[model samples]
Structure formats: structure tokens, C-alpha cells
Target: MRKSELDTPCILVDRVKLLDNIRRYQGYADAAGIALRPHAKTHKTPEIARLQVEAGAVGVTVAKLGEAEAMADGGIRDIVVAYPIVGSAKLARLIALARRAKITVACDGIDAAASLSEAALQSGLVIDVWVEVDPGYGRAGVLPGADLDRLASALVPLQGIRVCGALVFAGHSYGAETDAEREAIARNEAGTALLAAEALRGFGFPIESVSAGSTPVGRFASAMAGVTEIRPGTYVFGDVMMVKAAALAIEQCALTVLVTVVSRPAADRAVIDAGTKVFTMDGEDSAIGTGRGYVVGHPAIEVAWFNEEHGILKLPDGERGLRVGDRLEIVPAHCCAVVNMLDELHVLDGDRVGATWRIAARGKVK
Candidate 1:
């Protein structure tokens, strides 16, 4: 079967590009002497995660416990739950997962560590955890120096939980407009994580892993000293946002939405069968242009507007060539979000349908 024969508004992944992307990033990690624990949130497919492991990734990282459970069920043994594990119910689940795999969770406070310790002790398991450091995102991590020191001091007495290292998500690099800015963000991420690790070691804590970087700064952070591992989720499937950030070329985008032009309302307007439901509300960088996605073959055309189920295209001047039933490929602004909206991905071998892979962890937010 061909892409054209598939239903409208479906996701397609180029198998060749997918494997090439995995090998490319793995090669970078290997050359930089850093371990690659790719965040599995991008595809949420265990098959892809296994591919990364086969390509030399030390393990896989996940944003949620449910995602970790999914990967573990799929036969992955080394897993990092990048989010802080909280609550008695969730802790029970975390301990259960630890029984089957090597689980390293992220913690931001002494209270979280204490809870993890209690749960692990109850289950007769020791859980490895990383202290999360904020890399300018003001998200879910403590700052380096005093903030980190305080947390470490309080955590030292905790039982059944050992602080292994510091985890940094330099997600702020996603907003960088140039290569220099990305490099700076990467340096800051590396510096912040290294500072935290050094401070912890000064406090007599055995620090081993310094996991840092997002896809935007993976290359820079991986090459920096003291960072033992990097977690880049979106490198496996490039998107328009990565293109805008200058981290990936459009051709490197392995995932694309296949949609059919259902209506041509005017000379310069046409509508496709994909919209916010297919491609999330995530938009491209405004400085570069305005669109939720990039038209694969039509540069001038823009996804001018969108509704819940339809995308309005502003056709290029003098081009009324888009007719009903015409199909087009779109690179979404955020591949991770786009993928989470789907239940399965139709993988393409060249232009023909190759196989279908279930998004094993789709909507696994627990």
C-alpha cells in the first residue's frame, strides 16, 4: 500500500530517515565519549526505543512513570524516569518497576526523596535518583549552589535512596534563535549540572552521572567535560521547531503528517483534513515565519489557520493548483506533541507502506 491509499490525516515515518537519525545521534554520543540515554517521549514507541538501544544508547529516558512502565514491559531494562516520583500510589508503582528494571528517578526536594525512600524500603528495594537542576526554565528543578546544597544535605540521611547525579533539561535552548545562543545555553546546562555534581561531591556524596541537554543542545552538551550522559528526545524525529532552532534541516524530519486537500474555497485558499487535533497548537518560531507546520513540497504555501479538524492553507500567488483529494505532507512544529495525539504511526519504506507501530506510551501521563 501507498501513502495515498491510507486514510486522511495520518502520521507517516520514513523508516530510512528514522534509522539514520538514531545512528547519527548515537555516533555523536560515542565520538564525544558520552552515553546516550535518549528520552523516549518523542515517539512513545518501544520499537523505536529498542532501536536506539541497538544503535548504542546506554538506556532510555522517560518523562513519566507510566512511560517507563511501557518501555520496561517492552524489554528495556535500563530506564530513567526523568520526573520526580511522588505520592504513595505512584511510589508503589515505581517500586514495582524497579523490580524488573534498573530505575533512576529524578527528585527535586528532600520530601520527595523521603517518600521515595519509604516506598523503596517497604518494597525492600533501593532506588537510584538524580537531583534535578533547573537550567533557566524555572521548571521542576532546584538551582545550583545553595539550593542544591540544601537539598543534598537533607537527602543525605534518607534510606533506600541514593543520589547518583544531577539531571539538567536545558529546554530553554529551544527558544534560542542562533547557533551561538544554543551553544551558550548548552554551556550553561553543562555548567549548572557540573556545578551541582561538584557541590554534591564536595559534600561527600558519590556523584557519577551528569545527564544534560535537550535535542537543541545535545551536540554541545555531550562534548563538554563532566557530562556523562545526554537525553535528547526530539533528535529521532526532526520537526519544524528543530528546523527553526537550526538544529535540524527539514530533510532530517523523518515524521510527517499525510493529509488530503478536501476543499479549495478560493484561488489562494485551500483546506486540508488535518488541524490542531493532528498537529498540536504548538507553533513555529514567529521570527522565522508563522505556521503550525511546514508544507513539505510547498514553501510559499502556509498553514494560515486551523480549526479542530481542518487546516486552512494560504496558497502561493498564482497557484490554484491544489484541488480536492490532493495529498500533501507536513512536518509538524512539535513532533513529540504531534505523536502523542496519535495511536499509531504508519511507517513508510520509501513511498510505500512498510509497517505499523503502536504508540505504546501514548497519553501515558501517570
Candidate 2:
């Protein structure tokens, strides 16, 4: 298979670039004296996860139990369910997963902790737990201080749960418009998580792991004082968001959508085969020059709109270099979401096409 032979609206991952990203992140973590447990939700493929582990990743982090089970089935032993899993049916599967591999979970409240403990106790497993700290994401996680201590204290009475330490996701760091702003958020993520870890320790709980993760923060991981683990997903496939934030380079982008120019309706506009279905509505970035996605080689073109199957492209300079049947490579704003929209990614080792990697964890958002 070759790039020219691949159909439009397809995904292509440069193997060399992918391997480079894996090793680069691992090297950074090694130099900082921290473990790199990459988030598998980015690629959602066991093949990629294995490569990450082989490249010195301590383990893999997943956003759901379904993804964890898929990775575990794919032969990954050390897996962390980064999301809080609740309910009996889900807990049963969660515990069953514990029987096969070492599992750690992140929970923000005592209720989540108690439910996890019940699941662990049912399976007769002592699973490690991380107290999620709200590092300004306002998503999940309890704030540090009384809430942190309270969760740890609640876990003390639980038979199957052990408080490992603290974890944080500096998602707000992604919105940073400048290097200084990004670095500032990175420091905040590390500092806030460290405070929670220290508070957990002050309560006489054993604080073994302090984890902070985000591609933006991962760039300045050295700011993470007292952090023992770092998990970054998008570093594997630098998207438009990472590129605009100065966290990644355009050349470092490993994943892109192969689209074909299907219509040249006007001189200032054209249409491509790829649209929201392929590149998705990953949306805008402050630093990125375009919305939805940016054409890899055609800076003169902007992806202005999408109509499911059609991509509305515009030329700011009014120069129509694109013609009907022309193909374009798009670096999407969010590679993770773009990946879930597809079943397989056509891979490349330099110019030669490699075997396709199945999205083993797709739709496993349990």
C-alpha cells in the first residue's frame, strides 16, 4: 500500500514520527526522574500502547474501564483507569480486570472511593487509588485540604483500597496562548497536586505517587516538583492544539487525515472529501490560524466549514492552487477525537506503507 493509493477521508500515521514522539516523551520523563505513564486514550490502540511501554513508559493511563480492559487484553499489565468508575455492573468488570493486571484508579470523592472499595473487596483485591486534585479543571477531583484529607481518611477504613497519592489534569493549560502562560499553568498543576500530596501525607497517609499530566504541562515537566509520574497522550500525535500552544511542532504531528479535493465550486473556495466525519469538529484554538483543522502543506487554505461529508475550504489570498481531485493532508485540532471516528489508521514507516493498526479501544468509553 502507498499514500497515493489510500482512499480519501483516511488516517495516516508516520511510524517514524510516532516512535520519535514515544521516545522523546520517555526521555524527558527519565531526565526529570519521573515515570511516564502515557494516556492510551490518545491512540486507543494496543499496538501503540505496547510501543510506548517498550519505550520506557511505566504503564498506560485510560479514561475508561472499557479502554483499560482492551489494553489489558492486549497484554498490558500495569494499567490505570484515570476516570472514576461507579455502578455495580461496571464495578464487576472493573474488579474482574484487577484479577488480570495491576490496576490503579483515580477518584475525587468518598462516594466514588467507597464504591471502588466495594468492587475491590468483592474481587478480593487490594487496588491502589489516587486522590484526584482539582488543578483548576473544575471537571473531576476534590480540591486540596479538607476534601483531600477526608477522602484519604475514608479510604483508610476500606479494606480493598489503598491511597497511592494524588493525580491532576491541567486541561486549562491547553488554552494557553503563550509559552509563559503555558509554563505558568504547568507550574500551577504541579504545585497544586504537590499540595494535595503533602496534605495527604500530613494526615499520616502514605503518599507514594504524585502524578501530573497534560501535553502543555508535560513540555515543562521540570516544573513538577515532587511529582513521581507524568502521563501525556497528545504528545504521541501532536495536534493543531499542541502545535499552536508551542508544545509541539508541525513536523512532529504523526497523525493526519488524507483528504481529496472533490469540487472547485469557485476560485476562492473548494471542497474536500474529508469533513466533520473524518477530521471532526475538533473546533478552534487561539493560536492556530484556522478552525476544524489546518491543511498540512497549504497554509493559503483554511478549513472554514464542514457539512458531514464535504469540507468547505477557503483561500484567504484568493489564489486557487487547489484543483478538483487534488489530495490534501490535514492536521486536525484534536487527534484523539479524530481517531475515535475511524476504525484503523494506515501507517507509514517513512514512505513505505506499513500494516494498519486497529483502534482496539474505540467506543469503549464505559
lDDT of each: 0.87, 0.85
Candidate 1, residues 37-118, lDDT tens digits: the string is 9999999999999999999999999999999999999989999999988898899889889999999999998888998999
- In model 2, the clashing pairs are none
lDDT of 2 by residue, 41-65 (tens): 9999999999999989989999999
Deviation of model 1 at 304, angstroms: 1.4
Give the top-scoring candidate (TM-score).
1
Q: What does candidate 1 score on TM?
A: 0.97
State the number of backbone clashes in model 1: 0
**What TM-score would every model get versus the actual structure?**
0.97, 0.95
For all the candidates, what are their Cα RMSDs to the real structure? 1.4, 1.6
